[model samples]
Target chain A: MNLRIKLIPYERLKREDAKKLVKDLKEGTIILVDAKLDPKEEADLIEETMKVVSTKFSGIELSSMELSELKETTNFERFKNMVIERIMGKKRGLTIIGPAKIIRKIEKNPEELLLYM
Target chain B: MVVKHFRRLKNRLASAIRKVFKKKKEIKIGLYGPVNSGKTTLANRICVDWLGEELGKVTSIPHETREIQMKEKVTIKDNGRSLTFNLVDTPGIATKIDFEDFLKFGMKRKEAKERAKEATRGVIESIKWLDKMDMVLVVLDSTRSPINQVNITILGNLDARNIPLLIVSNKVDLKSSSTSRVRTAFPGYDVIGISAKTGAMVNELYKMVLKKI
Candidate 1:
């Protein structure tokens, strides 16, 4: 319910920073990131997060689909699962790119997001 | 001629059978949460899963739930009660967007601040109905870092009224989900994690509520 969603840049994060992020996040925090603003750094972030969070995370590709279409992919479904689990007070985590392009793509393909949150 | 008569007789019998069990008990269930926390999505999921009809709109933009939405006569059999649970979904509660943030994006400072003030007032108006509900389901988005003030305010007010609450961790199906922390943040309340989209833990949620209401 905290109106202020904490924005964290994946670029500024260290490999061992999960503990802190986890602490702030478990407290019901929202993070805002700009993935498309810096593709290289975002890619590095996704890569580094996977390394840290392990295989429980999956790779997702949106291509040119709108936001709606993006949600339908198996990967989006997985992300929604992670989000839902977190909300339930479960501790599983996932790594996702906060790309406006990706957001646009999913928006274009809203159907894909239909099955997931 | 004989076929017509038989069809008419069948239709009459069906109506008679339905009438015998027409009476239903209605229970009102309310879904409330902060902005962007998926209140409508949860409501849409319930409509799809239980009512077989999606009654509300879903949007990613915060404050999309600007008004109170109610879907009446939702029938659910719980414990020994034959109940009709009306699902009421409310808008997000956020202190309006700071005018300075918009001004920083290139708007006039005074104009931006005024707009921000108006937005803050809108948020208050949207959440004022918390006092009139039978139950409150606080929806929290799990992907973000947990913040204390807004939810604490919501929970504190609800607790003051002694309203039975069910904290729903929505979007739980997303990757990087940390629900345990969500549980810890809210010390004394019934919490449940669910994929509102996949309908994962909803049935279990029903079981929990069945005991309470």
Candidate 2:
């Protein structure tokens, strides 16, 4: 299976982006959300991403959780924009959303996620 | 009531015996890193220390070993600590694999595309086998910037799994090599500097592995 990973920023999470996201999920393209582009709190990221990915696509739920966390960061050189993530009391990393079937399969056995690669 | 207690005691005793025996099993120590980070070279260094032979081919070209390579039953003993493991040298991990990236090395378009495909698949296989590893050596080019996405992603995956890892800051023979930079980037992990090609500090790594394990 061909996997298309879309790295959409938080600012561009508009209606057209939502359409493209749902369309890609239907076709099994992996969506990676980098919230640093717009800088939001962790709760807000979950809310907005869930709103776009969950209700529109029936039977598909957004498995939004803290997959990664920034326990400590001494500087803000590499991730300049994402520094706001720390300021907003949120961590930084990609929020992955995908087709319900694919997400289900990965959750059932994360070992099987390699199959898409 | 005493009979029921005896049955439960028996089950716990059996489980304890299984755990003690299982710890003696050989660990799978995977060599994981970005492309051309000297994973194969380090694997060869350890293999030569015990087996008197090298592991795989090394080249300046990226993705040279686009598959999993293993040497089994390599045991290292130092100062009462010993680690017997299967040394797995895996192809490097990259966030993106493109045929155009390979073309820079002066390869034909067809071969480059084929190499790119195999390299991408190799990355997936490397990740799939991550769960099987008892330990991992995250090799890095010491001179380069340690804040790249590839390094962070690799570390994040390992951290998620709670896998034990040692960061190898290799190629220290070069003028620009800075093991301290890599250490600063990853504060807590054990970052060792070495010239894998020259076997410098390789023995120290073996002893360190036993300590870490």
Q: How do the residues A24-90 of candidate 1 rate in per-residue lDDT, one tens digit apiece?
A: 3334443443222222222233233222221122212121112212334475565675576457433
DockQ, cand. 2 = 0.05
TM-scores for the candidates: 0.51, 0.64
Off by over 4 Å in 1: A1-117, B1-27, B78-82, B98-122
Candidate lDDT scores, in order, read 0.54, 0.66
Clashes of each: 56, 0
**Could you give candidate 2's per-residue lDDT for residues A30-109 as a string of tens digits?**
67665322211222222233333322232222322232234343234336635655685444444555554454422312
Please give, for residues B1-213, the per-residue lDDT of candidate 1 as tens digits.
332344435434543453355334344577877778888888887787678999777855445565678898777665675555788887676522434455555668676555455444445444566655666688888776444334655765665455567788877889977778787655456679887877888877777666555
Angstrom error at residue A55, model 1: 45
Give the CAPRI rating of model 2.
Answer: incorrect
- Residue pairs with backbone overlap in model 2: none
Q: Measured by TM-score, how close is model 1 to the native structure?
A: 0.51
